[model samples]
Target: MGLNHINLVVKEVDQAVSLFADYFGFSLITNRNSKMAVLERSHQFVLVIWGQELNRKDEIPEYPENFHIGFYQEDEGAVREIYNRLKEVEGLKLDSEPKKIRNTFGFYFYFEKLMIEISVNPFKENIA
Candidate 1:
């Protein structure tokens, strides 16, 4: 089976949605106060956002090193593009540079308490 999607616990759903819409090419499809709010790209990769109470009930307590959301960039240049864009984005911190690791190139950035990684998915096989 394919990896379905990840749900983020966000205080501000609109802010979180807009941020991804603006920078990561996401477009909103549906949202609810309690149910998951969904965003999709042209590729149909989905991002689901959940509110606070739901998060407390459902998600595990994350450690500092673990991120709630992670994105994989297509290639090194795409990773760099985001690295440059991070300068203009307000609420983010760089975890590492857009450099090579094994067969992938990537960088990690944080928004509030959430850490998102952008990297090349180097495997040709669909393990997901």
Candidate 2:
């Protein structure tokens, strides 16, 4: 079977929802409450964001050093377009401009505690 959905725990559900909806083209499907939201992309991918308040601990969640979620674009130009748009966001910690990273052309950045990668693989016909 194919993969279904990803549930991400973030410090603020609304902020995460805005990032995915406004920048990544994800449509807000529903908000379960102030603590959770569901988003969907054109390809039927679901992204669920859960607020940190649901956790038993009282601190921020920390992912492994190199752990990140990535989105692939159709081409380098598409990747660069996203990079440029993200650069204007007030407090996003973008690593740098898109460049060759191993076999892909892309860039990385942190939104709150989540590290996200936007890239394009030149050799791949389908980027999904």
Candidate 3:
């Protein structure tokens, strides 16, 4: 079976919701007083963001160093388009410009404590 959804716990649920909605084309499905939100893309991928309360400790969740969420683009140009758009957003810091990474063309950035990767698959033909 394929993956269904992903849940992320962050310090600010509303901010994370906005980032996903405004940039990644995820539409808000439900929002619970800024403490949690459910969003879905046109392809049915669901992303759930939860505030610190979800942990029951009121502490901000920390992700492992290499842990990140990735978004695949159709081509290098699409990857660059997203990179350029994110650059115009004040306060958002991109790790670097889109470039060759392993066999893919992409870049990485952080929104709050979550790392995000936007890339174009170089081995697209290899996948079914």
Candidate 4:
């Protein structure tokens, strides 16, 4: 089995959408009001952000340092580039540097109310 998508319930969909699109180059596929937006990386997978019904901080899950979304990358150099790029962002916390993992290279980082991990990898075709 494979993973389909990750849905993040956020307090500000616009903010989250822009952060992903601006930082990671993902594009917005659609928006359900200002409360929700769907982002896509090519045609493969999506990250959907759904905002608060009442706009209350207590209502949404707080972004934690350890909680993150990880994406696959093609090479170590590319992974390190991302790591350096992310270093400029204010108040960002990282779990680890971009490093090799089971032949994949990537990093994990988190910011206020959001977390992400992006990498480059060719789509895996079924092989035996």
- The numbered model that scores best in lDDT is 3
Candidate that would win on TM-score: 3
Candidate 3 vs. truth: CA RMSD?
1.6
Q: Which of 1 and 4 is ahead in TM-score? A: 1
CA-only RMSD, every prediction: 4.2, 2.1, 1.6, 4.1
User: What are the per-residue Cα lDDT tens digits for candidate 4 across 99-127?
Assistant: 65554667667655567776656444433
Greater lDDT among 2 and 3 belongs to 3
Better model by lDDT, 1 or 3? 3
Across residues 1-128, which tens digit of lDDT does each residue of candidate 2 receive?
Answer: 86789999887788889899999889998987868899999876899998888885656678889889998898999999999999998768998899999988999999887899999865686546
lDDT of 1: 0.73
User: Lowest-scoring 10 consecutive residues by lDDT in candidate 2?
Assistant: 119-128
lDDT of 1 by residue, 38-109 (tens): 898876477887766565554433446653465777777888987888867776677777888677788777
Query: Scored by CA lDDT, what does every candidate get?
Result: 0.73, 0.88, 0.88, 0.72
Question: Of models 2 and 4, which has the larger lDDT?
Answer: 2
Top-down lDDT ranking = 3, 2, 1, 4
lDDT of 3 by residue, 71-91 (tens): 999999999999989998765
**TM-score of each candidate?**
0.70, 0.89, 0.90, 0.65
- Total colliding residue pairs, candidate 1: 1
**Positional deviation of residue 32's Cα in model 4 after best superposition, in angstroms:** 3.9
